[model samples]
Target chain A: MAFATIRDVAQKAGVSITAVSQILHGKGRFSDETKALVRKTVDELGYVPDSRAQGIRLSESRTVGLLVPDIRNPFFADLVSSMEEQLYEKGYSTLIGTSAEDVQRQDAFITTLLGQRIDGAIVVPEGADSPGIRSLIDRDLPLVFVDRTVEGLDTVPSVVSDPYPGIESAVDTLRQLGHRRVGFVAHSSLGSVNVNERETAFRAIAGELLGEDGAVVVDCDNSSRSRKDALMALLAEDATAMLCAYSPDAIALIGLLHDRGMDVGEDLSVVSFDDIDAFRLMSPQVAIISQQTADMGRQGVEMLLARIGAKRKRRAENRRIPTVFVQRGSVGVAPQAR
Target chain B: MAFATIRDVAQKAGVSITAVSQILHGKGRFSDETKALVRKTVDELGYVPDSRAQGIRLSESRTVGLLVPDIRNPFFADLVSSMEEQLYEKGYSTLIGTSAEDVQRQDAFITTLLGQRIDGAIVVPEGADSPGIRSLIDRDLPLVFVDRTVEGLDTVPSVVSDPYPGIESAVDTLRQLGHRRVGFVAHSSLGSVNVNERETAFRAIAGELLGEDGAVVVDCDNSSRSRKDALMALLAEDATAMLCAYSPDAIALIGLLHDRGMDVGEDLSVVSFDDIDAFRLMSPQVAIISQQTADMGRQGVEMLLARIGAKRKRRAENRRIPTVFVQRGSVGVAPQAR
Candidate 1:
């Protein structure tokens, strides 16, 4: 027997093929009874509608393109997982692209996704002003920015944590623990919103706590060797305590300290931002400024879905998920001499 | 001026639209000079070939479907990232779906990928026997299994780790350190090839070290809560040392030991499989049996690409990547009296 197609189901259900396609795609107008009857006919007929055929008819692939900075990073992994969960529940497939923190790669990914005719995109923009991303926005493609925001594009919805408050709280807590000269080790400059916000907050809090001179910001280029160098510079400043902007840098800092025979919590108090699975398992519990990555991912999907379902165009909204300070054994009281 | 299309590029390059399309898709017979000319024309004309149009013309989409058991797991995360990198270099985009360790969810993901008309699929099968996966195989889909292998399927190529030597080494090291009553805590049953290999090797090693009745295996369902129960059971065995089969389970084991005021290395030597990111950072280092996940992913892509490019059908091949045992502070000389 020949395999039954959507045409067969539609003919059996006595409805237009367009109606059958709509019901299958979960789009267009259809009443409950009609939908149920069509579904019943589809089941009874054993009609396996070819996805390619449906795509051709609807001109919609029902796929969303997801572009992340780096998938090796645990934070992106969690984000992608959460996004997939929410998007899957809503009947959308995800096409993922990793930029590897390269602007050229980001541009290439954008072009590839666009060429694939993805329904929309959720990109963690590579830079604050990526021209390729700007072109995507210009083309009126539905875009949702996650983690970081573009400087010029105020219309793209971004789901990110308000890093300033979290940084302030972290600095305040360290200061309260009698730490005056605190050092900051960040992976990059204030180019990205999150990094800039964190550095700005750290500087503000430092000024309030111990004047502007008290805060020392060391921007590490994020390479492992460079991070080690940055750690050495930060430690050389005689800073009693240090705040890490990300997990990899924090992990590297720990290794550097251990190599130099510096006790983590005793000799140098350290706090890392962005808690990952590995961090919780580490021996000397490093204090963490943990962002709700899973929550951000879940919320980002909801926002994207809302945009997809809206009748009229919606303005871009920046949703700030909260971050909490997880104080582990890594934070200690400053010594009397220091 | 109107937006440059494939037709414009063809006209500008003085080539037939079919030839230009073929060159763009990297299909059909075309000289390198002609291909370069078309590419140069495309660049100069700023031509953007519509992916929908191209997809319709060619039955094969330049997209591979990737179905992972869980993305939040760092192992899978790192694997997916590596696969994406390799596939991207080969000009194939990846559409990712997470099954969340559910067979039903995996089935759903497969069906969705089929609907999207993915060129091929690389799945990390969640169960030993998945009927949905079987159906895909029956349909003659190009499928490659990674990390885990499904039972009763002989035609699918798979990339996995040879866990025997690693497990044996871990057991031997533990025994050398005077751990006679050693226990094993696994997150999943001995159904998966990797898990089964580890279990079989551990059992063999245990029998050699402390007779047949000495080996204690606690199989825990892969959940955070269930892992705690498994840890408790393993601890109750009064084993001098415990070998955890996975990293997340090891993290939970450490927490459980700490909660009970049991020193990890001194009271009960703890060793885990999979040296995940945070393991080294943990207060007490957890000895780990680590797999080369990146290598597995890269190899999987290479094999899949070869299959895609093969002129004649090649027989399915199974490749085993190596694993390493990194002994840190977690595994030590078993307690003096235990």
Candidate 2:
């Protein structure tokens, strides 16, 4: 159980403790052979650098906090996984938190994160206005937003999907399939910028492609009964094609459709946001607005790193990763056309 | 942008700094009004306690490192989410890492976690042998293994699912459906104790239920080619029903079946471990061996808390949560019986 310390590595490598530290930190000049010897000995002895002490001395924790609404959502899971991978490669650990889409939880996590004194943070905000986020901004910590952005936090860089291209293409596809009525099902968290943008895009594009009256919209809370009500309202409108502003809502609707013994592609065409793995594996694959989550994760980290490394203060620009429409078996000809 | 100090909170609350500290830490007696006033002032000023300093002073970071092989796996995602929730409720922040099922990455994360001076760690290990795990044990830090365990680290408490009950019930279901041949398809990560146990249970149960030659086993290397080969080999053995030891493999197999224009419930029966959301949403729902991940997460946290709170040192005991079999449309009559 004895841990190998700097002294142990130095003794074993036949070098001074100062030399070992310099070699490990890659600071002072050392011969290649000496560096190799030190590294080999460090590996053999399993010497882990005391990053806590280093963080105190160097004023850099080399750890970044990642706050997401929920990891159970596959999109967030992929985002966390991707960011962690890239961050690890850059020699930084990830501190993770889930807001559970609750403002209190988000603030609590942010409080803890600030106490940790992490070098930076990337957040998928629970809502537009968070006192915790405000504190982060006030402290001038390197921070970036991913997938979702908050209100009044315009100066912070965000990596979000541009919903227009994907919504336009989906509506056009539905129009080409002779669908005159297109409905949008949205999560009830209307404060979310992502949801607002997606719904707005759907409303504008579906209105243009299928006429103003064709664009029906309904909101559903994250519950089976609410989702059922939303679907029923959409069906009552005689809409044969629908888009889900949220992926989980789409998944629930598909299950509801199956429960009613209605074929998805046959009875009602369906498309949802986020190209999650489940959509690809479905019997009749569900089409989606691919958000390119990998790109978002990669760029979110890059933006945060850019801020962390910035020497001069300036306005941080928001970046958008374009969302693209992916057609699959979920979208088919309208029932009336059939 | 100036952070409110503890002295500022004390002044605003009309109390001494000693009283404020005592009230905040719940360490000293204070009048109810004084406590309430201090709390309100702290909240108004957003005075977050510096946990990093507290961690050093108390030698308790109030942080737990969680290392999972891959969060993209829904099972792991759920596990991480559940554990983080429970840990946070117990007043701890989670430091997260993903090994991506690589031992080097696992060791690197372990090193970083150790350097962070976390109070404890919970790991879903990559394999049966990890030098990082050995270091953790050597350090005598409170640790718990979930879902999977290591070979040499037997004394470490593990919360894993007992595969016997689920596999036995699944085999019994297949037998009742007139399936004389059953196969178990597994990921190539046979070193994982979970995979090994499930495969073993499937072999024993299938053999006992359907006679000696009824049990067939195949391994896939997480590629379409490998999964296809495994499925073809199972079909070549005339397996009317198959259980997936790993969920992703089952998902891949289902996709492969769809690619070949085969109906899962009608043409071939499919059952997979882990009752993921996607399984329930499938047109013909996939039968599953449910691991009760929420229970596992809850119990894992409880066990870790017990270890962390134990005043007297004692050897920890391993806990097993029972797995149950759920029948759905996927398991049907054998082709021959039909």
Candidate 3:
């Protein structure tokens, strides 16, 4: 039940494998009679041309490789799903790989993509420094970075959320609600470019809205103890508003807050990044800094297609998808006067 | 900066393409000098041998194709992430494609997989009948179905959740809470084998525990209007306990109940399937008929690897991961007498 290879088709059709390969690819000079014989033998032997071999002979696989930091994250899952659907509509199949935020794993996927000879690639890079990303740029692969991009690689086109508008609006809203200071909580991972950018944006915005010492930022590991410690630090700082740079942290904080008999929107105000479905289902629907994931996915694919269509010309333009603040029930006035 | 092809290597080494290919693959007779020349030329030119071309020459790709129905669904997202991790540890790269519940998309992925000459495949079939599945079977491709199986293809090995244990326990617990009947809400899509099985199991279990009419099943489309209609129909039937066969429906139903000024756990007990992260973040921390998604992902990869290692010897065994009922605040005492 093995697949009939070109050699088998050639043997059955009384020709060389090179003739069969060239005739099937519509390259090289071959008589009409020879082409007919090869086609008949191919059907008779049930030969499905190995696309990889065909890609070698023709230099196009019509397949794109994509790398995401982590698919377990809902935002990434949604982004990959949307990009896959759009690529499919444009007659390209996607090869998806997840790095799980490991630089080595990202390199491995990059090597795999190169070995597969994909037409182009879309990636959420692991961080600011990625040898794999540098290699892709060095090799001149038609590439687009989405969600996150390597720092100093401005020559590569990327689509990332601008964080400024969302952070500004959120800080302004909290300030208007009588909060003098806001606390920010996020994962302590230093390799994430987006999270670092988000935290920096919040700090600047809060400083402007509520003064120099208004931003209380805590970077914690994913352990429950660390999250609780972050919460305690916020309470000790007397910050009435809590901003989570990561959504999972927000969920964990809510659970911890509930355990301590604190109402989320009443005892302490809260807002977080990523509009995941869980936020809407929470008791007090949490406020969100929405990164337009669908637009990023669509525009990433569009940019990659344009680069591929332009024959690997590097596009130095970096596109930004502006984030917006959506106020749900999770924001409330400060428990004490300013 | 394009990749150096076999032709490029052969030209630089002053040898034929076949000689270079055979030398790289360690096949066919060639002089040591010829092999060394090809090797040196490959390194000098930075030629990454096309893995697909090598797969044709030697029928192994060290790659597997995976097909899931939807990636945006957290359950599927988690499943894919876990499976990809496991496969990566086993020295294989995964090519993932989502059907999005469209048969055409599923077939397209299948075609792409076959063209790519994958070493094997693990698919959550789109439905009971798939011409693509039939083709894989006909070609004797190493295949394993996960989460769901095609209706009449028992010859292929599969890993699916056994719904009886979870459904029976859930229904029995509701009955103990003085619920006379339980309403089951699910998608009206008839194509899903898993959802249909879950519904059927609920019917059988509820009938045994609370009499024949005790099982009320309402299948609705995914629209909000339809979900609301299904919820209203469940209320009209006077069913005090609600069993959602799908997780998203449970989320929507809970939101609708909140809007209608009804407490989920107090007014109508609820239990749904899939222990997704959102379920834990819900106000009432949903009770779930856990499918053990992590176990399913691990076992599916183990089975596929076994089959792939066995070289496509058909294994007719269907493995089942038991489902367990987890009682949370969502499964409080039903508000009616028997």
Candidate 4:
């Protein structure tokens, strides 16, 4: 990196390289004035400790790593951007890694990141008890989980969005719109406690609000074709509204409905679980269960930084960010009500 | 970093640390079989050149870096993922960096990448005359420009989308729909040659398709508030259609129209310049001039790899991908035509 060299730093500080080095190493008989000048020049030049240098721990790597489940999902991508912005303000660069929701890839990524000399990490883990996660905890690395926390790794500080509030509100809103049967497009992946929690809440609220037969669950993998097929089947069964549990897949069902000559909000309403800016641009602005994603991201970074600085492990606790229902044009009156 | 140590490598290779060191340094009197065995073990261990070891240039870093204007842009994000998948097959990890459309940040990211011993780089530049880009070219680094190219860097290979065909198709589609006056909301950035090219194409096509005083251009400075004002002025002038030049700000104008009780596709027609998969989810499905972003990314990686292999500089050519117009329900008949 052509970030200012020590020699350049010395020249700018008006001191010998030896004096600068001595001051950096906390040695030699240098005046406080000389030290201050050297420090100022170093900061001005944005000179990081050379990664090539050995036996000298001049500085810890001022970088934090983040492992997200799926970078393609705008929800996670937006969250990462927020966390990155906060970490940048603290003078830390973010190294991002995406698991793509594959356990093998997630493990490989974790192994790869361990080679980068990152000071801390924030991960939306693939599975609660994945071997890679166990190894990470064993290493005592500074880590804060976000979005989803593993069952056994509860001791790690976590920031999660509770899905119950949003689910309850969505059910009530759909019921008021004269929808007696609302189908849910559920993510196929299991073993993720976050997904499981969302599924359970969706089932309970749907039954309570729309009757026992009102709750219809269609499961499909992350593939757009699979998700669309399941959704179509649910529609054939008289589902007036499709409440998509996953944000990335929300677009899939909408596109499918359009291709089939069905209009969203008018023919069939769609309430997406995770709200993002793009959803607002749609013709019938998508109603959503707004998870406080930005808040979760900010909290994750704050907790990670705290862990990085602490001499002892702090009491790990789950920081729950509540969700709210955002009504938009997507929640139109059902055909029965009309 | 918790990567395997040299001692671990020696053990796996069934050799002494000295023997491994000698073989790695090309100074050992070892049998060719032993050398091959050591190499095999090293590869299996996913080992990279030890950057910390002084005077040891063991292996070239098998990494390719990509710099995008904004990571939050799904267009760029999808392209990066595609390129990354391709590079991974060739045993190269992709290092991603974002300029966030800031020249200073772009330069800083470039400097940072230079320190990582990256084997090659693919960049969508901030401007034509960015000093950091010039320095990379001067150093004879293997580089490929994607999406946009800087004005004086004609010798650099670039993959750019040809906007003429898409513009022509869009104008023809609008004309068929009986739209006499079409107003465009264009991006505010001027230093970007890509934006300039699109603006030129849009003006020419709109003028040819719509009669005199039928084509209107309203400049927006990236703010939703100002963009809405400019769009309102265009609508006030009796424009039948509003075409957004930038995808990100497309929402602002659409949201404002919705708030004003004007329903898109019914009250007014609209078209978007760039299209992503998510756009299909929108109600009335946003019509767009589609740029083959994935193809551009795949081609960029191939061009970069080709550059990395050649000992001498090769001919630099612009690989232009054609664009197509994707129609949905957004286009409507003008009141006079109807």
> TM-score of predicted model 1?
0.72
DockQ of each: 0.19, 0.25, 0.26, 0.17
lDDT of each: 0.76, 0.82, 0.82, 0.75
Interface RMSD of each: 4.3, 3.3, 3.0, 3.9
Docking class of 4: incorrect
What tens digits encode model 1's per-residue C-alpha lDDT throughout A184-250? 9876643566766777777877888777678988888656678777877877887888998767778
The sequence of per-residue lDDT tens digits that candidate 2 reaches over residues B1-338 is 23457888889888998898888778798889889999999767655443233243236667788998888888888888889899888998787788889988888777666555477889988876766777677657788999987776778999988999999998998889888888899775646767778888887888788899999899987666888899999999998889999887887788677667677777789999997987876657899999989899999998888888777666868888999999999889988888
lDDT of 1 by residue, B7-92 (tens): 78888899999999888777899888999999989756545344333332135566788988777777888888889888888888
Stretches off by above 4 angstroms in model 1 are A1-60, A128-135, A176-181, A189-193, A210-241, A252-270, A282-286, A327-338, B1-58, B128-131, B173-183, B188-193, B209-242, B252-270, B280-287, B326-338
Model 3's DockQ?
A: 0.26
C-alpha lDDT (0 to 100) for residue B4 of candidate 4: 42
TM-score of each: 0.72, 0.77, 0.77, 0.71
Query: Considering DockQ, which of the candidate structures 2 and 4 is the better prediction for this target?
Result: 2
Q: What is the Cα-based lDDT of residue B112 in candidate 2? A: 60
What is the lDDT for B283 in model 1? 47
What's the TM for model 4?
Answer: 0.71
Worst 10 residues of 1 chain B by lDDT: B48-57
Model 2 CA deviation exceeding 4 Å by range: A1-58, A189-191, A218-240, A255-268, A332-338, B1-58, B189-191, B216-240, B252-269, B332-338
Candidate 2 interface RMSD, angstroms, 1 decimal: 3.3
